[model samples]
Target chain A: GAGVSQSPSNKVTEKGKDVELRCDPISGHTALYWYRQSLGQGLEFLIYFQGNSAPDKSGLPSDRFSAERTGGSVSTLTIQRTQQEDSAVYLCASSSRGGVGADTQYFGPGTRLTVL
Target chain B: AQSVTQLDSQVPVFEEAPVELRCNYSSSVSVYLFWYVQYPNQGLQLLLKYLSGSTLVKGINGFEAEFNKSQTSFHLRKPSVHISDTAEYFCAVSAPGNTGFQKLVFGTGTRLLVSP
Candidate 1:
């Protein structure tokens, strides 16, 4: 079966530039999540989307970060006026259902975004 | 809020030797524990999960973990390791909310170095 996929495996942008990362969840998956992994650090939760419900934006660090899932399948994470602190690997994951203990999340290879 | 701790930043073991990665977590409510593995240049893959029932859970690639409620630990172990097992391992926890939406909190990660 096809796994979750992400675009732009590596992205380099200047500070103050805007960058967008894309994720394609597995078929039939109704839950998607976005996370960031900094160097020598664990993954940091960013946002979540489950079916038709309102997305979880509580984890967003600031107003510059936003995400949207179109048609409940693909998701795009946008960071406006990127900062050097935003340089990290952006990871995307999906599960068969939404909930805490519902299912295991399948992750994408991730997009490594570098802000110079 | 829940938080996970991977005590060891790195663990080096010889091929065919036993290995263990220590993980501990703290949460005020019931939680789901999971172990994930990330190979070089790859996304994370589910190694195992402990939701309920057996305290000892086995996962793919000959890995297992013991969930200890008293100590708040879910340590990953393998009898004999291979060079292929050299990768980063992460411990995560999630507390389900009333709406059935859960967010994962991850540990810093343990880097396993398997030498042949």
Candidate 2:
């Protein structure tokens, strides 16, 4: 079976430009999440979507960061007016279900976003 | 809010030797614990998880972890490791009651280097 997948394995853009990262969750996975991993740092939660319910945006670092999952499968994280601080490996993950103890999340290879 | 701490930034050991990566978490509520491994140029993979029941949880690639509630720790241990075991390890925690989403808080990863 195919695991979660992300597009544009690497992206380099201007600091003021906007970038959109895409994620395709494993088929039938109802919960999806996005995270950021800076060099030599931990994975920072960004946002999450569970079924048709409201997406959990608490972990989003700022208003410039936003994500939307359409049809409960594919998700896109868009960063508006990217800053050099937004340079990092953007990772996406998905699980069969939602909730704290429901299932283990499988991760994608990630898209390395570099703001120059 | 929950947070995770990986005590060691890096651990180097000879092939076939025992190794341990320490992880501690802080949260006011009960949480689910997980260990993820990331090989170079690859995505993160689930090594193991501890949701409930037995304290010892076994994971892929001969890795295991023990959850200690009193110590607030979930350290990963492998009796014998291969050169392939050289990679990054991350510890994460997810608390309940988060609007049906399991948002993870991750620790700064520990880089494992196995030498012959």
Report the number of the highest-lDDT candidate: 1
Pairs in steric clash, model 2: none
How big is the positional error of residue A7 in model 2, measured in Å on the Cα after superposition? Answer: 0.5
Per-chain TM-score of chain A in candidate 1 equals 0.94
TM-score of decoy 2: 0.95
* Chain B TM-score (model 1 vs. true structure): 0.96
Question: TM-scores, in order shown?
Answer: 0.96, 0.95
Every model: Cα RMSD to truth: 1.4, 1.5
Model 2 CAPRI quality: medium
Off by over 4 Å in 1: B97-100
